[model samples]
Target: MAKTRRVSEEIVCAAIRKRKKRTHVPEADAPKAGEPRSFVIRRGKYAPMLKDLEKDLRQMMMPNTAKELKESRKNVLKDFVQVAGPLGVTHFLMLSATQRAGYLHVAKTPRGPTLTLRVLEYSLMRDVQSAQQRPRCPQTMWHGPPLVVLNNFTGSEHLKLAATTFQNLFPAINVATTKLSTCQRVLLLDHDRASGRIRLRQYSIVVQPSGVTKNLKALLGRRAVPDLGECKDVSEFLTRSGYGSESEGDDPDTTRVELAEDLGKGNQKARQSRIRLHEVGPRLEMELIKVQDGLCEGNVLFHAYIQKDPAEIAERKSKEDEREALRRQRRAEQEENVRKKESEAKRRRRPQDDARGAKRPRPEGRVPWG
Candidate 1:
């Protein structure tokens, strides 16, 4: 039998010549559902599949939806608590429906775009200038007309907020629009020409309104009516009376920290958790936390999950590395000194040739007669 011929270089070169992209067998080119079909790449055309794949990827990654849900279910307290830290009970306890929606969305919840209990306008309504012309607040089912409520709430300047708000700010049943609080119903500005002094006088507003008969007492006192808290879709803010500037104050950045903690500690143990491993600074910044973000999950576990005080950690690490370098430099210096001593000793043991070390000293080496 004739021996098998060896493949020649020209034949091998022709075989190795680049083929058209279409002919090249791709690893896996199965078109998934909702994917576009592959196209012919001719005349050095750019690969169309890459753009499609990239577009598909972009459509796939939603920035916050999943993360928000995972975070909010547990981190709700951390978020609200940090909010509460700055606001008073009245301000903190209450949030308008719109505001509440914003908070939930900020915390990454999908409460909105569903049942939009949007509060058009929310505040104390104090005036009913005319029966014909009255301010109407759209939110009537729960709050009635704010003017009526303000009539019930607005007391003289000196009186405490709680006492005045309950007495004057109480809603009147005569909100024909169920929107405007008529002046008689909410505003308590009574003028008397009989006493001719241009002065504003304080009125008697009661805090412990015991023994007084209210127009709505029958409905209010009834146990079946349920507290305002139980009112469906009612904002807790409408119930509270007063607020102050001190409600907003210097507060720590507890949102990120608490959120990280709650998700880690609660019953839901995500794939990763943030736990303190060591302390770096005066605050709890140095302690290592297992970052829950998807990007940090794989190779970065041992790399130190640092979100806070990064500058400080970097500076400290830099100093440490520098110290090590300095130590190494000192060690090298000592080694050089030892080598020098050895060389000097060897030089001392070696004999020197004569005629003053051969062909006389160089002129540059000679010293002038002093």
Candidate 2:
């Protein structure tokens, strides 16, 4: 009996240990100090805007624009970034329909953060292992569940679509809509006519700014306020039109009280003030994710906490170190090669010098030594 009791206690302890291991850690519940507070913002109205933007972008890529496409894309992306938050463009992948499974776009932000977006368009129904087909970012590992966003649907339809997409993309991962404190993954889904398949995509949002800025001065010229002060309308119109009485009127009419206020003075002050006011662009940092093609509409996108893993950081550092080491090795080898070439050239010339000896003119008094 005592042996059985001892065995039961052991089993109980093992069970407790197993349960502890299975418990999940909610890492992304709160934004880090420097991290932007992530909100699952959604609005379906932005779908049309996305569609139009896609059309314009496609038109720009037609022909003779391969060279200019990069700049054009940045500009286009800038506009998209501006409208994304209001128009709810966070879930659409900003790639063309022809983009393959592993295409990526990177935009630099003026405030020193990089916006990197990638497309992973593979199928879970395939015979291959899902992980093998899953798209991967080199140094990034999303360590939390994502917020799931449903577009063009609401009420029961929204819930249904979210469920269906979640199952299709993340089959085994269990997520709860009510208990959302432990999630950090974002899943965006939309119907794709090009492929005729409901496209499922996963995207993450970290607040970042688009570095490109519209140079107000460059666009509108150095002078923001028009020089109307000196033009005919303000300078000579009243005088030329005889609106102003002659400065020295023949009859000193006291009936019209001499107006003490200068009418043009206020206009001048207003013009100067307008000129002094600098035209600055919007400063709000945009957090937008672009899915190549489709519409994402809903009041709530995916919501999940996000956190960085120490392992991933260590791995990235190791990779950088490896690259630095390789560069040093290559530089050392290059230096060695240069030295070897110089030494070989000197050695080759040394024999030639001996053969040639000193080619000085023989003294007139001295015969050849031979």
Candidate 3:
């Protein structure tokens, strides 16, 4: 946990340092000849309105930076030294209290009671697990009951997986309730952590976006996962046999159509046309079991509480959200890949389309033959 905290502090420091240099216009402050000339921040003349930009940037970077950045640099230093909530002490301790006091620090705080901190030699440790997580953040262990699966053998597997994913993403989901993808990304981070971290561990297997989550209230209402094992994550177990139908060489369009037919109902055939809970359920369960089993086989961490520290929790949640968003964005991008492949397959399967396509008249300068 301490290491995780340390990792978090380092990350924050790096981000602040990075944001500090985010939009630096070295040109704005560079010396044309010899003197480091100071010029009034010229709005719209020599540079983009830097003062406002800096203010806006600080607002996001600085703690609750909505108001005027009335804090002197000295305040930041003081906060670091005395009221070092999460930031370290020495980084702000070895300082001249007089010369460089600026808006950074609100006010000089009396130093806390002295305590010794022994610096240790640092070495890189490699993680070999399969879970996903931030570069290295705390784990969010969801100590909950095992998932319910009275439906089928596949149901047990997927329910467990969905349960783990539910637990893994619970925090992220809370933070980004309005955004499902963000929560999903956080869950994946847990998977990465599962396979990698030595100190912090994560669960394996990632659940698909099933009604498992969107209808969590209903599931919990019905008392899901009554006899769940004392497992950290459900990874080591069986994963859904294959990812999607195509990974198993099943046609997705055919799968979708078959699914629609299986759930056919009277009066509103179109209503059941899209993907259904039953259609996606079996696949979801398989993934759950695979991931759960993986975790059970000593590939998981058993901290129970993923992250207890509020600061770490907040930071990790932010990371989970950011990571998931990227994953979804990447998935969206991958959809383009799926479409490209599908398009090519269509071109191949229906050479007639290609022939017909070639025969179409060109609209000057388009596709050679638009």
Candidate 4:
């Protein structure tokens, strides 16, 4: 027998590095339209549900966002913001919980217009998968960002801003240049005007050849030979109507689409395909609580419940200004003290230098000429 080949550690590591280089998207190669990178993080103590939700959010913002970002209680918003600029991260999705409710803070990096949303209800991915009979979550589904669909997010100024923020979270797609195969997922944000809440749902996009019986589709799959043990003939097997077949009474207008390109094995160009959406969850019902002028803080631009009069707003502004001035004065005083201490240390060092240079009284016995 031939000797078994042994791969050295260095060779394995080099191969891994090479693979990473090929897969990694460098900042220089990013599209001119600017693809937004994000950090989906949780702050403080959180329930298991919220932690899972954070993971699902990270998965939804795939290819560009950090999927396995670790954060501790000691880490602050500023720490992530400081690092985001260098790494080209543009958005932050921070989840936090209190005794009353859970909150999601969506903020643009290093700046203002943070949207605070209260989570009314949520369902994790595991929960949704377990409930479905056939959960479809292929690994290829996460290779690209989901297509965002915003419904009924118009009319109000706050709604418009919220819509814009959600749109900016993902890279824009050019229909002419974009390939159909890359669109593996869909993110739906439906705003309920009556309830004043937004429903978030993520789905995996699947295309199947339309106008084909289930038996024919299975035969084309070729993964395994269908068991024809009970059938009398091959024709009977192929023309079987109700043998382990799903309901196919779906509306043609809503589900059918013309394939612009060859998407997969059975989905060929110009072929009629049926589009189906499988909910891959972390579903949420959220209400916009407030929109702030800064990252997680600063003046509130919009509040759902509370309304402050102009006088109260002016007073608050004045108080903020006064506090800022006080902080500036204290910083200036600290700098002045630091400068004075440096000068004092220099003066002390000069006297020490003089003492060292006294020259030992010029050696009392030595003549001045010598």
Candidate 5:
């Protein structure tokens, strides 16, 4: 009996240890302090194109952003901004459209400095996939955020601000601890210096075994049993040039790299792997229209088309200040009026309250036995 009890206790302890190990979260996976979380939402009337673009943007900002956030025409920017504070949402990507064009607003939460970009052209994910012969979108591709890559953003002041805003939209990665497996996607923002336009491309990072023939890879890593009826022997099938021969025949020196860690199936550490970026949908060509001092409002810091002189800027600032002062005065007067109304109401109720508390006249009737 004692031996059985001891065995049971040991089993219990082992199970507890296993549970603890399973529950432990690595430091790299834990939410970092001041990490940016985002909300990609649409405002105003629904545009069919904008709806799909919003979905793509949400997918691009995976894990750290709300994917299924619902918005209606009745919902205003203030509604989202008000809730953003308590929920720790640090950025907002608001998509809206007019009859003329669509706009993407990237704004910092609870503060100023919003970047507005006009969408010149866009391609949905479905459209992109339709054009490709084989689109590589894995089920777990969006399990983590995409790595942001900025190109040619060093030209002007506005471009610098835009780049900063774009960078903060995703959480920062630590080079020392970040795993290669988690980097399944890439968000490339390429800016054209002459055209002043930005091209947004989303790609999946594909790592395949290097120095392996296409036929051999297919035989080893076949998802389903590939038809073997074409050849009498397996060697014949392996030696034959297949449909995707051009990809396999390319020089591997340019794209091949030594893997630092184990990534994906058969991509082991210290092994040579070919890294390829496959464009996975939702391309956008946009131009920075303006940068504003506030969320979707306030003084324009940069405008692509409009340039104001110093005197004009000064006059605009003075006018804004006067308008703000007037608004404050009106608010103060309204508060005073409300306070007076409350006081008058209290004064009127005071006598009635006192009368109720006072003793009624017991005089009319004769008193009796005590």
Candidate 6:
């Protein structure tokens, strides 16, 4: 046998390094002609305004920021409601940011890009000026045109920022104003009122500083009741007309009668009732029902009644019953047919099986061959 020579580790490593050094590898270079290169394209002008908008968006998306925004909006709406309540403005329609954006209309004007905002104008029957004599009971009709609000938002420092933005995007449809003022004070008002068209009322908003104590002289003095229970408080706001408990003052004859003996007793499930005396307070007592010249009693505006003939209903019921009975009868007949077919198949197969068994040859007796 020839003696095999064992290669040393250093010799093998040197041979691998020599081979690697001699090997030719390709290099990664820039793309040549006709080669595709990745590139990005951006639309619109990318300026400081875009940066500011992006920054505001990021701030709005931050944690707790969205909640704070919602709370702020609620407070703003509540303030509006409070201010409008005394102004005889009972209804309000608040549009969301998306809705406001959808209604935005842009038109090129000589001055610049003018913003027109369309807002609902509420006109009460009382506000309508008629030449005819007022009836004893006037029928209050509520209908108003869509108010048109115009603004440039150039110098909107004193104006409400949100309202200014809203008006810029969503303008009113109709132009109506109580009086004529300067062009700056009114919407679309020009030097020549006769020749000027598209003139509308300029929208103005004033947010009063909260927490300012009103003058005591302006308000009437009244006694204060610390506890709500001590005062007889009743609300006219109820789900149904005759649902709420009658006020003791409204109906002095109204009385509470307990049907169960357990009632008014100190039982676990008993309802406790007591004849208590309390004074009415101004704060707790609210007059929900208003009395106005055109106002009417009752809150129901529209009612619908659906009537059906008894004979038709009875016919429909009878048809349904007949359908159900027919379905049951059909199901029973199908089951009986299936059972009969199975029995007939079994009877026919039994005789054939017996004949086949008889035809089979019996095993011959084995003959022993000694």
For candidate 6, write residues 145-243 as lDDT tens digits: 112243332332312332343343222333353211111111231112232222222222111111222221111112452233533543222222433
Ranking by TM-score: 4, 5, 2, 6, 3, 1
Model 1, range 1-370, lDDT digits (tens) per residue?
Answer: 2333344655677888957788663433222232211111111123222232222212111110011121222333336434433331111111112322211001111111111111222111121112224333222222212131222212333122222322322223443433111111122222223421111111111111122223232333345744566455433333333322213233333311212112211212222212221111111001111211121121221122244466866786688689889999999999999999999987876655333466754577556762
Error of 2 at 15 (Å): 96
lDDT of each: 0.27, 0.35, 0.28, 0.86, 0.86, 0.29
Q: Candidate 2's residue-wise lDDT over 125-202, tens digit each?
A: 111223344432311213333444555333444234443433322223343333322332345545433332344444
lDDT measured at residue 71 in model 3 versus the true structure, 0 to 100 = 30
Candidate 3's residue-wise lDDT over 1-370, tens digit each? 9999999999998988775466653442222232111111111222232234233222212121122323333343333334333322111111111222211111111321111111111111122211324332212111211122222222334333433332321122133323211111111111222322111112222222221222332223343463326434433112223222212222244223211122212212223122312110001101111121221221222233242566875776688688879999999999999999999988787977667778546577667545
Please provide TM-scores, in order, for all candidate models, with all chains considered together.
0.14, 0.25, 0.16, 0.78, 0.77, 0.18
Q: Is candidate 2 or candidate 4 better by TM-score?
A: 4
Candidate 1: Cα lDDT at 29? 24
Candidate 4 scores a C-alpha RMSD against the true structure in Å of: 5.7
By lDDT rank, best first, the candidates go 4, 5, 2, 6, 3, 1
**Model 5 per-residue lDDT tens digits across residues 197-251:** 9999999999888877676667757668778797898777777776345247665
The C-alpha stretches of model 6 lying farther than 4 A from their native spots are 1-306, 359-370
Model 5 worst lDDT run, 10 consecutive residues: 243-252
lDDT preference between candidates 1 and 6, better one:
6
TM-score result, candidate 2: 0.25
The ten-residue window of minimal lDDT in model 4 covers: 1-10
Best by TM-score: 4
